[model samples]
Target: MKTKLLIIHSSDELYGSDRILLQVVQALRDTYRITVWLPVDHQDGKHQLYRMLQERAVEVQHMDMPILRRALLTPKGLVRMARLAPQVARKLRSSGADQVYLMTSACLLLAPLARLAGRKKTTLHIQEPWGPREAMLLRQLAKFTQQRIAISQTVARSTGFAADQLSVVHNAVPRLDPANPPKPLELDADCARGPRYLVASRWVRHKGHGTLLKAWSMAGCPGTLYVLGSAPDSANRIDVRGMVAEFVSDTASVKIIGQVANPQDWFDSVDALVLPTDTVEGCGLVALEAFRHGKAAIVSDSGGPAEVVDNGVDGWIFTAGDVPELARIFDRCTASSLAAMGEAGLRKYEEKYTPERFDENMRAEMPGALLGS
Candidate 1:
C-alpha cells in the first residue's frame, strides 16, 4: 500500500501557502494518499483549492475546533493542544499515515501531537521568518520535526535555522502557455506614448506601494500603472488610490483598477511586472507568475525577488526603497532591449518553474521520510 500523508494547513487562503499546498498535493497524489487539514472556515480560494484537490482525486478533510485555533497562539495554544491532543492522536493512530507535513508556521504547533500520533516523521514547511517570540516557539519545537523545508534561502537564514538542518526549495507554479494566452489590452499609439507596467499584490504596507508611489512620482512616470488587489476597507485601499491621485494626468496613466479574480487577464495587458516589496517575502510567487507569462520583472532586492531575478537577464533588480534606482531600472526596461529580456524570463520559467518539477522534488523528499514500519 502507498504511504499516506496528513498535510496540516492552518488557513486555506488563496495566498502563497494555500497555493503551494495545492501544487504539492497534485504532485504527490500518485505515490501517496493525501489528506488536507484546514482549521479555518472556508473562504474564496479555499473553495477553489478544495475543488482542485477533489478533481485530482485527493481526499479533503476539514476540522473545526475554533477554540483550538484561538488557543494555538497564546499559552492557550498549548492548553488547547493539550485538550485537543487526544482527538488528533486518535486520527493519527487510526489513519495509519506514514508521515505528517505541517504547511505553515501556525500549524507548527501540531508537531508534537503528530509525533505522538505514530507519525514516524514530521516535516515542517516554514514559510515565514518569525521574530524572537515566534522563533523561540520554533526553537522549542524543532526537535519534534525530522525535516525543515524553507521556501527560500533568505527565509531559512532569517529564521536562524542552521544550514544543514534545512532544505531550501523554490516554490514552483504551473508554467504558462507562451503561444496562446489571451491577447493584451490594445493601446492606441497615443495611449502607448508612455511606458506600461503592472504590479499584482495585496494592498498592504510591506508590499511597498508607498515606495512605488514615491518612485513613480520621482520618475515622472507617464505610463499607465495597473494595480491589482482586493481592498478590505477604504483606509487600506486609500494609499493606492492616493498614489494614483497624485499622478495628475488625464490619460488614465495611473489606473488603479479593483481586485481581479483572474490575474492572468491583467498580466496579458502589461509590458512588465513590478514588485517593490520592502519587507521579507517568503517567496515572490507573483514574480514567478510574471516570469511564467514571459514578462520581465523589476523587483526590489530585499527578499525572494532577488533570488528569482537575475540582475539584467531574466529581470531587473533594485535596492529596496531607492527611488532613483527604481526610476532608472523602469526607464531601462522601457527600452527596445526589454522584449528580449522578457523572452529570457519565459525561458527561465519553463526550465525552472513547473508543477512537474515540484512533484519530482516532493517525491524525492517525502517518501523516504515516511515510517518504514
Candidate 2:
C-alpha cells in the first residue's frame, strides 16, 4: 500500500510556501498517496494552489486549522477552536495518513493534531522567520516532530531549532522554456528615458513596493518601475493600491500589472527584477526567477535575499528600506552592467536552480521524510 501524506498548509494562496508545497506534491504524487489540507474555506479552481493541485489530479481538502487565527483569540472564537481541533484531528485519523506535512509556523497546531490522529511522523516546513509567539509555539512543536525544514539558513537561525533537528533546503525553480529564451529587452523607447525593472509578488507590506517607490523618488525616477503582483487571499491589512499612490511622487512612473495569468512573458520585457523588501523576507524566490530568465535582480539586503544574490556577481543587494542605497544602485547600474549581471544570474540558475536539481536534492536529503516506516 502507498504511504499516505496529509499535507497541511496555512493558506491556499500560491505564495512562496504554497509554491514549494505545489512542487513537492507534483514531484511526489506518483510515489505516495498525497492529500493536501489547506486552512481556508472552500475555494474554486481560481485559487492558484488548489487549481494546480487539481490540474495534477491531487486530492485537495479544506479545513480551517485555527492556530493563531485572530478570531480564535476572542471568547467565542476560543470556544470554536476548542471544538474544532478535535473534529479535525478525528477526521485526520480516519483519513489513514501515514505521515503529516505542515507548512509554515501558522500550522504548528498540526504537530499536536497529527499526534492525536496517531500520525507520529510529522514534518513542518518553515519558509519565513518566526515572530516571538510563533517561535515559542514552534519550540512546543519540537517535542512532537523533529522533522523540520527551513527554506534558508537565515530562517533556520531565526527558529532557534537544533542544528540536527532542522534541515536547510534552499527553494528551487523549474527550468525556463528553452524555446522562449529571454531576448534583449527594450522597455524604454529612449535609452535616456531610464532603466526599466519589475517587482512581482503579493503586494504585502513586507514585500517592499513602498520602499521601491520611495527609492525611485529619491533617485529622481532613474527608470520606470513595473509593479506586478496581486493582493493575496490571506492578506487583510494592506491596502496596496493606496500605499502605491501614497509613496509614488508625481515624476515617477510605476505601472501596476496587478496579477497576470502568465508573468513569464513579462520577463523578456524588463531590464531587471526589483525586490526591495523588509526584514520579514523569505528566500527571494523572485530573484531565482530573474536568474532563470537571464535578468539581473536588485534585492533587499536582509534575510534570504543576501543568500540568493551574490553581491555584484549575479545581482546587487542594497540595504533594505534604505532609499538612498537603492537609489545609488539604480543610478550606478549601467545597461552593460545589468546585461552582464543578467548573464551571470543565468549561469547561476543553470548550475543550481533547475527542476532536476530540486528533485535530486529532495530525494537525497529527505529520503524517508514521508516513506519512513
Candidate 3:
C-alpha cells in the first residue's frame, strides 16, 4: 500500500512556486497516496493551479489554514495565529497522512504543528530566499522538520540548514513540442521591426519591472518588449502600468500583455526572455521555460538565474539592478545573436533540465523512508 502524504501549500496561483508544487506532485504521485491542501482559492477566480491538479487526478482540499505572510507578523496577527493553531492541529490529526509536506517557506509555521499532530516525518521545501531576520526565525522553525529540500544552492544557503539535513534539487519544467507549438499572439508592434523580447513575472517590486522599464527606455526601446503578468493581491504589488507610462514614451514599442494562462505560448513568439530581478530568486523557472521552448534568456546576476545562464553562452547576464549595463546589453543584442544563444540554451536544457532528470534527483535526494522504501 502507498504511504499517504498530505501536502500543505500557502497560495493557489499558477506562478513559479505554485508550478513547482505541481511538478512535485507529478513526480511523487505514483509512489505515494498524495493529497494537497490549499489555504484559499485564487482571488481572480481562475483556479489555474487547482484545475491542473484535478486534471492530474490528484486529490485537493481547500481550508482556512495558518499561512505566514507579512501581514501575519504583527501583534494582532500573532494572536490570530495563536487562535488558528489548535484548528490547524485538529486538521492535521484527522488527515490520516503518514507524512506531511510543506510546499513553500510560507508554510514553515506548520512544521511544529505537524509534529504536535503526531506526524513525525515532515518535509519542508524551501522555494524562496528569505531575508536575514526571517531566515533566523525560519531556521528555528526548521528544526521541527525531519527533511529539507531547497530548489537551488542559493536557497539552501539562505535556509541555514546543516548539510546533512538538506538537499538541493534544481527545478525543471516539462518540454514543449517544438513542431506543434501554440500559435503566437499577434501584438500591436511590427514583428519585422527589430528583435522581440519578453518579461513574464508577477508584478512585484523585487521582480524588477521598474528597472526593466527604465533600461528599456534608456536603450531607446531597441526592441518590442512584451510585458506579461499582473500584480498579486498583496501589499508588495507594484504599479507596473504606471511605471511603463512614466518611462516609455513610444507606447506602441512596449506591449502590455497582462496575466497569461500559458506563458509558453508567448515564449513561442519572442526571441529571448529578460529577467531583471532586483532580488535573489530561488530558481528562475521562467528561464528554464524559455530554454525548453528553444529561446535565449537575458537575466540579471541575481542568485538563481545567474547560475542557470552561462554568461556568454546560453544567455546573457547583466549586473543585477544596473540599468546602464542592462541597457548596453539590450542595445548590442541582435535577432541573429539571440537565436544562436537560444540554440545553445536548448542543448543545455536537453542535457540537464528535463522532467525525467528532476524526478531522478528527487528520488535520489529525498529520504528512503519518505519514498516508502
TM-score of each: 0.89, 0.89, 0.93
- What are the per-residue Cα lDDT tens digits for candidate 3 across 113-152? 9989999889989999878989888988888888888888
Candidate 2: Cα lDDT at 328 = 86
Clashing pairs in 1: 71-77, 72-77, 224-253
RMSD of 3: 2.5
Tell me which residue pairs clash in candidate 3: none
Q: How do the candidates rank by TM-score, highest first? A: 3, 2, 1
Instruction: Give lDDT tens digits, candidate 2, residues 287-334.
Output: 999998888999998788789899888889988888888888888877
Candidate 2 segments exceeding 4 Å error: 42-45, 178-192, 231-252, 368-373
Give lDDT tens digits, candidate 1, residues 1-373. Answer: 8778788787656678888998878777788778887764435544766676677777876675232233345875667556776887777688677788888767765777777776778888888766666677666776688888888888888777678777877889876666756665655452465667788888877788877877776676657777888555434444678666764344256677767666786776677788999877778887888787778888998777899999899788999988788877766556356667788988888777777777777778765543222
Worst 10 residues of 2 by lDDT: 364-373
lDDT of each: 0.74, 0.78, 0.86
RMSD list, candidates in order: 3.2, 2.9, 2.5
